[model samples]
Target chain A: MRTIRFLLQKEFRQIFRNRAILLLIGVMPVMQLLILPLAANYEVKNINLSVVDHDRSAYAQKLITKVTASGYFKLRGYSASFKEELRKIESDESDLILEIPQGFERNLIREDQQQLFIAVNAINGVKANLGGAYLTSIIRNFNEEIRIELLPPGRFNPAPVIEITASNWYNPLMEYRFYMVPGILAILVTMIGGFLSALNIVKEKEFGTIEQINVTPIKKHHFILGKLIPFWVLGNVVFSLGLLVAWLIYGIIPVGSLLVLYCFLSVYLLAILGFGLLISTFCDTQQQAMFIMFFFMMVFILMGGLFTSIDSMPDWAKLVSRFNPVSYLIEVMRMVILKGSGWKEIWPQFGIIALFAVFLNTYAIINYKKTS
Target chain B: MENLYAIELRNITKTYGREKQVAVDAVSFHVNKGELFGLIGPDGAGKTSIFRILTTLLLAEQGEAWVEGLEVKKDYREIRKIVGYMPGKFSLYPDLTVAENLDFFATVFDTTVAENYELIKEIYVQIEPFKTRRAGKLSGGMKQKLALCCALIHKPRVLFLDEPTTGVDPVSRKEFWEMLKKLKMQGISIIVSTPYMDEASLCDRIALIQHGRILSVDTPENMTGNYPGQLYAVKADQMYLLLKSLRKYPEVLDCYAFGAHAHVSFKNAFEAAPLKAYLRGEGLSEIEMKPIPASIEDYFIKLLKT
Candidate 1:
């Protein structure tokens, strides 16, 4: 315990003395939290649309007006021919183009049906797909209106239909920011905890101080704890700062108990810090340690289900994500903050994190060699 | 089961890399309690390797070592408590002030600065004026003093200092040796290594090592006293040419350039007149010659030749 106190004192002094790193730790995460959620939105809006109306009939004009008025697209311009509309798409001026054949109103009254063509730019697959779906729904609504007008109101009655009213739970309006803020907060904590402690011992090795420390009477467990606790504390400090930013900038206060969130954070930080120390023990230089940490953080963040739902991933990816510690924290954060889950609801996740804390830390302690 | 020595090593060998480069060969030596022993060698002479083994910072692949009557491999925990090590480089926390480094090391050994003040007082007082300065900002000499102070704060039974005075100035080097003398009086056994040949005389005994092997081990007096032949110092107007001429002489057993003069040893004792005649015949002028006592450096060169 006494040895750990001295080691902690030295570590804290070194950390605070480096003003540039202190600023990076304090400001970078908050900035990322405030700006990233706004940019990482999945809601596609304001799609650019173009029309090549060859018909010039009342029904075609009405359809064009209805598509523009649906609020899912912006009209680039009206082209006289399909070739001109293709030119608009090639020039990057439009994302979707609609064409209506000539005699559309006569054909709709005489044969009771007509077909329209939609040429969607498939370069950005998601945008094109969603845009096409929105335009189809609008056209369907217009067709239903036409049918109702031609039926003379009460003369013919349609078959019975069931109305489906859908509601989004947890995020009533489906605000992407609410779902993203908690996940981003988890990433921030992981970055601070993992990178800093990962470089701790390797920095000592570079400076030649590890030789002095290794020759001392300090126990391996004592040294490991000394390294783990400081970064663990700093990780929590970053977590709290992120939470404050979430509340102040996005108005996202956790709906669950604050105690429960903190409880999970404390254990999660330990597992991550231990993993960092484990890397430090294996690497001989600071550069090696930094690169290795970068590799793992990249894997953990992309597969951790922060931006995408894990359920939508392939079977193999889902199985791989089960091993990522960040995945568990993201799940816990979203569950507690978005769903307002209780201890009983999150106990299983808590158990896995607690196991990681024990296993990773023990591995680090056992692998840390006093004599080589 | 008698433990008369503070440290002992038996046939210690260590190799590194896939090619198995031999760093320290099958070497063995011992230091008695409170004795000042020196390992004198140049940079790659394996002095650091031996110190690391005894200090429990490295493992020897083929041998055994004991510190303070405890095996270095098995009793490391107990050994660490009683031994202090100062590596060749200044390894203290550079961002930390001198006082903080000292306090930290002292606390790590479960003692306070005040408790062992007397042991490090003579050395600490010199750097105490700049106690608040970061260790990295101190001069080379002051850094050495601060490192010594940190090592001595625990009052260990044995202290290992590896090349403690290699880069220090002359005055600081003198002061460091004086401080080591004081620590010796306190009954603390000290083992120090240095590449500086002059520092070997300050030790009670030294092991002259080269190429990872012990060439000779003895007191400074005995090592120099055992020179096999008479030595002569010869200098002339053209020193480089004089050295070549001396090496070409049929009677000269060995010849090496030492500073301003060429130290020449002969197969047998001969008068300086014939040597001077030979040099003058080679167009040398203003030649001066004398017989000087062999120093540790002379003995080292002589051992290397064999």
Candidate 2:
């Protein structure tokens, strides 16, 4: 314990002594949190639509008005020819084209049926899908209105309409930042903790100081704990700072117990730091450690359900996320910060992360041998 | 019997990587209690490899080593407790201040600097004024002094220094040897390695190593005293022509350039007068020739060739 105290003291002195690293630790997360959520907005809007009206009918004008009025799309151009409007799609001036067939109103009244065509640019698949879904729903609503106007008053309809009124639980306002802030806090802590500790031991290797430490009588675990504790403490400081940023910028406070939140963070920091140390032991230089950490951070964050929901992933990808410690933190952050979840709600995830901490730390210590 | 040998290695060999390059080959040597021993060789001669094996930072593939009577492979933990190793590289945390570096190392071995202050006081006092300065900001000599102080902070029974004077200035190197002598007087057996042959003379005994093998292990005086040749230092105005003529001389056994002079080792029948006369006859002016005792460098070169 005394040895750990001294090691902690030394580590802190080195950390504070490096001015560039100090600024990086202080500035990086705040910048990322403030900028990424605002730009990474998932709600798609302002899709450009072009219309080719061969009929020039009143109903065709009404349809265009209704599509523009829905607030999901902007009518970019109108042309008499289909090819001209297709040219609009090719030039990147518009994302979709709607064509009204000739005699469309005569066909709807005489034959009680009509055909409309929508050509969607599928380059940005999410935007294209949402735009197509919105246009289809609008047309369905228009068809229902025309059917109601044509129905005889005495002739009763037998079919029932099922409607769904979605009430977004936990985040009633559905503010993307409210959902993103907690997850972003998870990423913030993971990155600062992982990158710092990942570079720590490998820096010693590059400087050749580990050779000095390895020759000493210090126990292997004691030395690893010495490396672990300082980062764990720093991880907490960064976590608290992130929490303060979240509360100040987004007006978000955890609905769960603060003690429970801290409890999870403490264990999560250990797991992540252990992972960093594990990466360091496998690498011989800071450059190698940085690249390897970057690769893993990429994998962890992308699959961590931070940007994409894990539930929607294929079986293999979902299996991969099961091993990602970052996912659990993102999940626990949402559960605690947004859902008002207590200890009972997060116990399973808590147990899994605790296991991760133990497994990773023990493996790291065992892999770090003083003697070749 | 075990107490007499501070460190011992026998038939130790190490091979590196898939290239199968030999680092230390079947090498054997020992350091006596309180003796200042040096492994004298040029770079890539496996001096650092030997030190690493003895320090337990590396494993010897074929031989056994012991430090303070504890086996290296089996009792490494015990060996680590009893020995102090300073690698060729400056291994202290550069961002850390001098005092912090020393104190951190002191704490690592579970002993405070106060407990071993008397042992390092002689060297530490020289660097004391800069205790608050970061280690990387220190001069090369000062960095070496601080490294030595940190290595000695734990007061181990044996010390392994790998080229402690390689880049240090001459005056600092002399002071460093003086410090080693004082530590030897305090009964700490030292095993120091150096590529500089001049530094070999200060060690109580040295093992001249080359190509992962030990060539000779003896006192510096005896190693030079036992040099087998009639040695002569020959200098002339036309040094290159003189060198060409000396190599072709009948009795000239081996000759090589040594600084500004051609150091030639001749057979027993060879004489200084004949070489001097031969140089003059070859149109070389202002020729100088004299027999001088072989230094460790001369012996090291001879050993490397033969």
Candidate 3:
């Protein structure tokens, strides 16, 4: 234990002595926390729509008014022809074009049906799909209203309809930032903890200091602990700073106990830092360690359900995410901060992370050979 | 009997890579307690490999070794506690200040600088004025002192310094040897390696090695004294030509250029007048020849030749 204390002292001194590293540790998370959430939003708004109404009937005008009033789109002005609308789309002025053919109202009354055409620009797929869906729903509602107006009150007709109402439980407004802040916080902490500790031992190897340390009587476990603790502490500091940034910028306060959040953070850091040390033990140079860490970080973050829901991923991806420690931490962060979850609710995630902490740290220590 | 020797190796052999390049061949030697031993050889002589194996930083493929009577492989943990190793490279933390590096090493051995101040005082005082300076910024000589200070902070029973003066200035190299002598006086066993043959004379005993093999092991005096034939320092006008002529001479056994003179040995003792006259007849002018005592370098070159 005394040996570990000295080692920790040395590690911390080296970390603080490097001015560039100090600035990076203090500033990187704050910038990422502030900027990444703003750009990560998936809500598609401000779609531009153009209409070509050849019928010039009341029905066509009403449809146009309704589409514009739904607030999902902005009218770019009526085009004279379908060719003109296509030109508008080609010029990047419109994302969708609705055309009401000639005699459309006459056909609806005489033949009891009419066809309308929609040309959607599929360039931005998400925006195009969501816009098309929103327009379909609005037109469906307009059709129901027209049917109600056309039927006489005395003529009785009965049709059953089912209404579904959705209420987002944790985030009532469905703000993406609320979900994103915690997830991003998880990634940031993992990065700081993982990369720093991964580089630590490799740096020693490059500098030839490992020879000096290996010759010492210090226990392997003691050396691993010394490496793990400093970075773990730094990871927590980054976590807290991210939380503060979340609270200050987005006004996101955890509904669950702060004690629970810190509890999970502490254990999560152990798992991540242990994994870092594991990489360090396997690599002989800082460059190799950095590349390996980068590869794993990309895999862990992209598949960790930070931006996309793990439930929606393919079977293999979801299975792989199950093995990612970052995924577990992201789940715990969302559950506790957004759902006000208690220990009983988060115990499984905590258990897995605790297991990772034990497994990875033990593996790292065992792999760190004193004699070679 | 166990405590009499500070280090012992028996037929230690180490090879590296798929081709099995032999780094340290079947070699063995021992250093007595409180003695200053040197492994004198040029680069790639496997000096660092031997030091690493003895310090428990490496494993010998085939050998049995002991430090202070404790088996190297089995008793590495206990050995680590009593052994201090300064590797061939300057391995201290570069960003860390000198004082911090010392404090860290001291604390790592479960001791404090204050507790073992006397052990490193002579070396530490030289760099103490720049205690706050980062180790990387220190001069090569200062860096050597700081490394030595860190190595001795624990007051180990045995200290292993591998090429500690390889790149250092001569003045600092002299000071480093003086410090080693002082450490030896306090009953610490010191084993230092160097490529500089002049440094060999400073050791109580040395093993001259080449190509991963031990050529000779003896006290410097005895090693030099064991030179078989009479030796001469011969200098003449056009020294390069004189060296070639001496090698072709019938009586000449060995001829090597040793800084401004050709160190020549003869197969049999002969009068200087004949050699001097013979060199002049070979179209050499201002020929001078004198019998001189063989130095460690002379003995080393002789051993390497055989």
Candidate 4:
């Protein structure tokens, strides 16, 4: 224990003394939390739409106004020629084109329906699909308005109409940042914990200081524990800072017990830091460790269900994400913060992370040899 | 049986790589209780390999080693407690202050600098002024001094220094030797390795090693005193031609440049008059030749040839 204390003291002293890394520790989480959530927004806006109105009627003009007023589309061009709008979609000036066929307000009243055409660019699939969906819904609302006006003034037209009501719970406004904050916070904490611990031992190896330590009476586990503790503390500090940023910048507060968040956080840090140590044991230099950590970090972040839902992934990918520690932490963060869940809700994830922590740390300890 | 030697290695062999290069092969040596022993060899003579095996940082494939009577393999935990090791490279944490590095190692051994200050004082006081400076900021000699101080902080029964003076300045090298001599007086058995042949004479005993083998192990004085051939230091204005002429002589067994003179060894005896007369016949003047004692380097050169 005394040896571990000294080791921690030395390790912490080194970590804080490096001004560049100190700057990194202070600024990286603040910058990532504040910047990434706003930039990684899932709700796509500013889609370009071109409208070609050939009808030149009162309702056709209203349809154009309704599409622009929905705020999902930007009316880049409004023209009476279909050739001009087709050129707009072809030149990538517009994501979609809504064309109303040549008719008076006559067709809907006389034949009960009229044909409208929506040609989407479909080059950028998400933006195109979302733009098409928004235009379709707005036209459906317009159709309802026309049908109501044409109805014979409470003459009891017998048509079965279903009225659907939707209310957004948890995030009533459905602010994208609120969903993103905790997930991004989980990732930022994961990066700091994983990279720092991975570099700790390998830096000693590069500097040839491990040879000096190997000859000492310090137990292998004591040395490993020393490495684990200082970085664990740093991970916690970054996590807390991220939380503060979340609450301050995005106005997000965890509705669940703070104890549950911290409990999972402490265990998550252990599992990720253990994984870093395991990599540290396998590498001989900081560069090797960094590359290995980067490769794993890439895999962890992509498959971690932050940007994409785990359930939406293919069967093989979902099976693979089951082993990613970051995914569980992200789930736990969302469950506890958004759902106001307590220990009862997060216990299963907690058990998996604790198991990961024990297995990785034990393997690293056994793999670390004082003698070759 | 009670172990008589402070350290021992018997028929130790270590091989590396897929091609299996032998680093230390069937090598055996010992050190006395308080003697300052030297492993005198050049850079790749397997000196560092031997230190690693005994320090429990590496394993020898074929044989056995014991430190303070404990097997290096079985009793490594106890052995680590009783030995201090300074590797060929400077291994202290560069970002940590000198004081921190020393204190860290001291704490690691479950001791304090004050407990072993006497063992390292002769070297420590010189570097104490810069204790707050990071170790990487120190000069080469100062870094070496700091490394030595850290290694000695635990007051081990035995200290292993592998080529401690390889890159140090000459004056600092002398001072380092002086420090080692003082530590010997404090009853700490020291086994230091060096490539400098001149430094070999300063140790109580040294094992001359080459190519993963020990050529000889004995007191420096006795090793030179038992010279088997007549050696001479020959000087000439045309030194290169003198070397060729000397090697051409059938009676000359060995001839090579050594400092300002060409050293030529003879099988049985050396007479300067015959060599001088021969040099004159070969159209050389101002030739000087005289019999001199062989040095550890000469002995090593002769061993390599045989």
* Candidate 1 collision pairs: none
Tens-digit lDDT string for candidate 1 (A120-237) = 9999988999999999989989998888877787865678867779999999999999999999989989988999999998998889999999888888898888888888888988
Question: What tens-digit string does per-residue lDDT give for candidate 2 at B1-306?
Answer: 265599888899999999989989899988889999999988999998888888899998999888888888888998888888888999999999999899999998999999999999988898999999999999999999999988888889999999999888899999989999999998999999999888889999999998899999999999999999768888888778988998888888888888888899877666667767877888899888788889999998898787
- Flag regions of model 2 displaced more than 4 Å: A149-158, B272-277, B280-283
Candidate with top DockQ is: 2
lDDT, candidate 1, B1-306, per-residue tens: 357799888899988789998889988888889999999998899999999989888899998888878998899999889998999999999999999999999999999999999999888999999999999999999999999999999999999999999878899899889999999999999999999999999999999998788888899999989998888898899988998899899999998999999898998876788988999999999999988899899999999988
A86-131: candidate 3 lDDT, tens digit per residue: 9999999999998889998888777867888888999998889998
Scored against the native two-chain complex, candidate 2 gets a DockQ of: 0.87
Over A1-372, each residue of candidate 4 has an lDDT whose tens digit, in order, gives: 788889889988998899987877889899988899999987879999898888889888988899899988899988899899999888889888888888846797799889899999988988888888888999999988887788877854587767898898988888888888999999999999999989989998999999999999899899999999998899989989999998888888899999889989999999999999999999999999999999999999999999999999999999999999999999999999998999888899999999999999999999998888
DockQ of each: 0.81, 0.87, 0.74, 0.86
- For model 4, what TM-score does chain A reach? 0.95
Regions more than 4 Å wrong, model 4? A52-60, A78-92, A99-112, A150-157, B236-246, B267-287
TM-score of candidate 4 on Cα atoms, chains taken together: 0.94
Error of 1 at A229 (Å): 1.5
Model 3 C-alpha lDDT per residue in residues B69-162, reported as the tens digit of each score? 9888899999999998998899998888999899988888888999999888878888999999999999999998999999999999999999
Span of 10 residues, lowest total lDDT, candidate 3 chain B: B269-278
Report how far residue A117 has shifted in candidate 2, in Å: 1.5
Each model's iRMS: 0.8, 0.8, 0.9, 0.5
